[model samples]
Target: MATSRGGSNLHWRNSNPATDSIRGGSAQRGIRGGRGSRGGRGGRGGGNASTPKRDPPPEPDIVAHPLGELLQTIRISDLSLEAIKTSKPTDITDLKYVASYNWMEGDAPTIMIPGKPPAWTPLKQPLRLKEDAGTYFRDPNGAQYPRYPAEPAVQAILNSNPTFPTSEIDIFACGSTMGNLLRFVRASSKAFRFSVEVVGKTVFFVRKENSPKEVIENIHGFGHSFPEAYTTWEEDTKGSSSHQRIVQYNFGGLVCVMRFECDGYLRDGTNQVDQKLSSSATSDENDNIIVQALKNTSVSHVFSTTDESLSIKTGGNEVHQQSIFDLKTRSGKYKRDIDMSDFLPVLWLKQIPNFIIAYHDGAGLFRDIRVQDIRNDLRVWGQEHKDDIQQLAVLLNKITKIATEDTRGLLEVYCAGHDLEVRRQHGDGVHSLPHSLRAEWEGMSDEAEESDDSLGATNGHGRSNFSYGDEDENDSSDEDKDFTACSADTCGYCGTCSY
Candidate 1:
């Protein structure tokens, strides 16, 4: 039954103190009865003794100790804070049975030591207790014998599902220490974690089965720029008869490599796709120059042996270098027809010994271009030389421009399939350098395991062991101030809304 709370509940007619006082009632009190004693109560309790009024308990003035000290106390003293922290306190009296409880298992064993100033040690081996006839007792309600007995059915279910399981996160570190540090920071960063879901060491990449309309947009979004190159004709040679050798033209130009490492995870059980999270480093072209150089052979492989002549060294020595570009097709051949766009070449461009620009064609396939390497060198060469590498980068930029502009068209061409041939424009020659000249290495790539996640693409996992601290040790704070959060509408930030 519903009752009307309108007329009688009206303050003017029922509880209006001002009008009541004017009408010969006692002096008016505030709505809360705080101003005078006319109303019933004040604050939490009123003066009426039989009304069963309650008084608030005094709040404890809490002093928190450092985590280490608290942990020591928890281990040494048998004093447990678990009861105080929880609304429902636990009774420690029956803790002897704790060994049988799954919740008792943890990273470190709880050890209680007694002394004037107590000390403790985590047990290397867990304790186990067996119940004998003397230890047996009736159930709390006397409905069953032996207060606690294992339920075989429930135990079976738990065993099948591995209930309350614990896992250890293992790290495999490789690459430069600096790279590893950035990766760790990126994984642990508030901004990166909150915006997207990422498992600690697991990474996933999503490349469209077919090229997207904004494939170039996607690449740039991942923080990479195009490279410049000079116009060159791909030479072709053919002759059924030794007397006649015909030459044909193929494609040639600027080369670039765009390498991106993102912290990500699978969205579904099938792992059909992945959601991209934050990048390990700030979105800067120069950030992964060393990483790109390692992964992209075209960018540096041809000049694999550090040439003293080309290398800038203080004592004049050859700087040996290696690349991340692993071999898939040792001979660089594909059984099925594949397009250049789909073939992301670990190959990139570098200055050749004879002053000629060179690149590891990855068997000279046009589709396998490395974008990041191109962008890194282009920026440096564009800044310093203004004449050589920059000019070449600008020329090569056209290829990417075309690829990006017509992503769908190029993707179609790729799906249809294509082939490239090799021909010699001139005979290879050798150049000698003075002993005083030598090349120096910037970084090294160690063995690493990359996982195949989705879209037939490989995502880098494991840990890297590189030191970025050396690069900005003096001005570490500067690194924090350099990049602002992305302003993209869908961008995920950990806490603050402002990008």
Candidate 2:
């Protein structure tokens, strides 16, 4: 995601004369002259002094018609004048009317008029509303009510629990519509958090949360999909089968590999009080005991295989899985007994950590001249623990096999420990071997010759007139040394011979 800065500024101005006339000029003048004539007089007069005043600027015309006269005849009264007062409170109070004739309550004259009452008719049945019910209505008293039939009564509750031939039932619902039903069941039960329902039968196992503890099965094979779900065992045990009891879990963003050892048998070699495993357990309970065991086990290590680069969480820190293996290399805790070489390809894709490269140098196999500062803390650790070099060599050979072409070539140069003509065949072939490796090898060779000369002098005790060899012979010895150096360069380590 590269971001760019600086851009050309674009300025826009309205060029339409109609828009300009509507905004800045008089509407009446613009209407009379039309759009093209607003600045016509000024522009033409400046160009031609002899141009006339354009027919006396055309007089403003006002032609009166019958509608105008009718509008003039209409009158509007002025209520503000004192002579035009229309409202009188005094006249209203004094107003009275005398009755021309008096009449009693029933003496009023009655006139008969012919009329007929509405004919009797049969009432029609009310219309039936739709299933969703008609719109509700509000009564005059402000209470709102639905205009639908009364709701049906609820079904009677079951007095006894439902039973089946098997303790656990497998229910299979087909079609896309079943998704909603399965989701409903999943949402209704908190105990079925890890339950998965496919298109086929979904076996529902009934297991007690506090069921008797059982042994957890060991995970086998690489590239196994993560478990659908797992449980944690509170108690731990020991022996060869103890590795099987170990679980991997994601804790605090790191992959933790914890074994179910006697409660205090820590992988770090610390000890604590051991928890005893139950001995007198019955075997004829049910198949749910196995399900409960799985539900009760905890993860021992946390790892994510989703990405090409596998990451393991350890010691509360998230790091590459290769780093975890490197740590195991130092601690000698890799009890799984799997060949480390088998995972080199996986690590190569993930990029090998620098510390692992340094470990090879510290093991006193040819120094891994590829890594920067190969003599760091990890290298020193590797030097102190040389017993693991054989395993480390296997991993190194696997890495060399899977490394990029350029990396393989660099490893070859590092192993050769001197510049070779064959290296110049690739990119930057003109460049010499790394100065550090070259200098180190030169110093080692010089020290070796010095030690040899000192040993000879010590062995030739009491000899007086000892003469050194001639210059020509010395040149021959130097040539012999160069030949030996060339022979050593051919010794393959990274599986690539520089010739």
Candidate 3:
């Protein structure tokens, strides 16, 4: 949480190669690499025999959310490129910024207006960095849902002066859900599963596994510590721990809204929108709703109760989508490259135009750092991966169609390695929003259709879209296939699977 290390000494490392390599090895041992163990490494930066963590700590205990229940399961084969060629390929279009909020460190779930990310303030010279410690939530609010991962986002939307249209939107998801589907399209070899439920016309994809809060363990890098050492939260939005942003776009024919975590932003909130567009090789489709986020507070929750936990504090500068960036830290010892093949899709999903990567010696001294604006690069990658993207569009359309067929409205999506399945959610599964908020969100159906129409989101011959934990007697009867998400043993990477 300290401000980025500062100095005017931006120079490549000039240290003994053999000595630095040994020190980097010790540094790696001091870090845990995934979301579950995000900031929980507690040993010195030494890979010594005495380090207790040489044996990783156990994964978190996650079970018995009253909501995850299987109503039905429809199995289908892996989507093929050949099959995609036969069907009309869907293209993502009409991207736009919808709403955003920051999490407050408090007892109940709270919101900060026009929430902003940490500012990018790199230190002038490389310095020995401290390691991260303690626990972190994959999603602080989501970890506490029935779960309504999208509830706070929608509430933040409605509370704005001019809310984005919601009626015609076909799907509401997070980066993990969509990314899982995209992986299926590309035919990935990993195992993954999530829940899908329908509230109104929008299908919500929730990634509620066994444990929402996880203990840090089994890590070997500086992904957490690097950011703590390098980035600083700006003044206006102080006291915030995490920021979530929502973006809407038409992929294939479906009008989609997705929420993602933002790392931080460039301090100079200049005309990044214009700058991004000027540099992009594509058209306005990439320019859908990047800048229309919430501004003023005008809360009007008809179902407002004195106990409502959502409080939108008024403060924060409007951060242009283009000015924001995704960050990753790596060790320079292995000379490992930052794989764009993996990172690009994430940037594309969030419409992030900038990426920052810092590479440090094992001793925690960062010397090789790069900040890039890769909007055009993402466009090119999308085109190159057009087949996978098209399959994703088709898959989404199918899920949407089938989920709507069930009168129950509530549903779940489970992808058991190799094939995709759509099932019924536990009747007890929590609603995506509170009763009042749910009513308000569904009521937006009136204007969402107009927005969907204007944006040209197609609803057929194309796709659709999944969370939570709770143990049930029914879980005993359910078959555990290649992966069983309800147990810590199967919650790949212990909830921070190698994404």
Candidate 4:
């Protein structure tokens, strides 16, 4: 895309009424009296007059990235709030008491969806109470509580154990009612793809391929309706759950697509671990094994591969491996941390492997971009170990394929919002979305889809094959009602809703 338009020369508009209104005026007043000279002399009013002009406020610096896009996705219409009270009074004590009574009784209340993604799920709604729950009634406290019907099917899934089958589950409770409905489909026993609209917002359980045709075709095949309901947000008791907290999925904010790519094995030649792989070594050997693992396993099986050259010899006594594929011309690298802490608080972190897909209505096309920087330290290690070249190649291939698949998946979910344009640039190499990602624009017209024009103009000297088609579905308008933030027609610009 072309750079932003530059500012033009400033031209202040002068508005001096005195010059136009004070045309040649006679010394005499226009008033007519019985006697011509009886009128009092009209005083000549003349003074320099000019309206003072103040400078406009400075524009905020444009720090562009996936974070800004994510923040923009958050809207206040999605939050549901309630009021609470402990005591019941013969007469209404105050507005808080009246509000609490009304809310507890299921009165109309407005929902507020913030523009910021919550750190956890089921974001708490702020409600003020007239009295504490304890003060309502002494013996059998008359305290009121906020309530909603139980989603039985989802509740059942939540009550299960580790190997929960989400095949038909809506675990997110996000439905057509939301902006975009994410349908996560397990393509293989070990790999899955969260499907949505054919635009953006999909997450692949594992990486797949980098071909444009493959990406588009995979997404275009998803069914229209959402699947069954899954688990609801629950507080863990054992403190052993994967998530620190859980909140309801709100469709209003930015839709992100994440994919995992694994290299086959480490390529470092320092150790003779290769002979051991072909030997009678147990699965335990492969558990923490880095470079040598790539040779034996199929590239399609592993999520990410580490390069032998990507190791650091600290103090000349030990070797440390890293998971990053470094590029000479591209702008950055990829991330591969498996631990919850490194990737946890998934919303934060600078080098997490995830793409922030956003739709700018004014622009008429969805933009795909990565949110964080991939680790460079680990990638450098991969480039240094060369003897294990085949393993390194396998690892690179797998990572590239998975990242591309994730880009495609997210575009599908964002289909409800706007048309997608996969940006690619020559020389920018692997870092550009077009080079590293693939996309499918759902429901695009044959003429638009066939034309090379679909590929948006290039920037920084690189070109892309991104397809530009239609805007999002019709917008739903809702101006009144509290408990609900938007009218039933639309989900308040969450991009997840269609009807």
How far is 145's C-alpha from truth in model 4 (Å)?
A: 23
Candidates in order have lDDT scores of: 0.16, 0.17, 0.55, 0.17
**Candidate 1 per-residue C-alpha lDDT over 1-499 given as tens digits, one digit per residue, 9 for 90 to 100:** 1121332211121212211221111111111111100000111111121221233221211111001111001110111222223232111011110011011011221111100000011011111111111111111101110111112111222232332111111111111111212222122211110000011121111111110111111110000000101110011101000000001111122111111111111111231112222245343332233224323311100101111111110111111111111111111122232222111211112110011111212222122211111223323432443222222222223223332232111111111111111111111100011111100001001112222233232222122321212323322332354335534342221111133
Predicted candidate 2 versus true structure: per-residue lDDT over 1-499, tens digit per residue: 1111122111112212211111111111111111000000010110011221222221111111000111011011111132133221111011111001100011111101110101111001111111111111111000100110000000000001112111111221111112212222122211110111110111111111110111112211110100101001112111000010111222111221221111000011121112222245343232234334323332222111111111111111111221111111111122122233322322222122221111111111111111111113333433443323222222222222222222212211111111111121121211111223223323333344345555343211111212112323422322243322222323211111121
For residues 1-499, could you state the per-residue lDDT of candidate 4 as single tens digits? 1111122111111212211121111111111111100000001001111111112212211221011111012111111110011111111011110000000011221111110110111001111111101111110000110111111111222322223322211112121111111111100111111122212212222111111111111111000000000001111111110111112221112122211111111123332111122245444443324212211211110111111111111111111112111110011111121122212222211122221111111211111111122334223422442222222122222222333343222221111122211222111111111211212211122223235565554321112322222112121122322324443332221211121
Q: What lDDT score is found at residue 493 in candidate 1?
A: 16
Which structure is stronger by lDDT: 2 or 3? Answer: 3
RMSD of 2: 53.0
Per-model TM against the reference: 0.13, 0.14, 0.69, 0.16
Q: What is the lDDT, from 0 to 100, of the residue 322 in candidate 1? A: 17
- How many residue pairs of model 2 clash at the backbone? 22
Candidate order by lDDT, highest to lowest?
3, 4, 2, 1
- Candidate closest to the true structure, highest TM-score: 3
- On a 0 to 100 scale, what is the lDDT of residue 11 in model 1? 18
Clashes of each: 38, 22, 42, 66
lDDT of 1 at 489: 41
Better of 3 and 4 by lDDT: 3
lDDT for predicted candidate 4 compared with the true structure: 0.17
What's the TM for model 3? 0.69
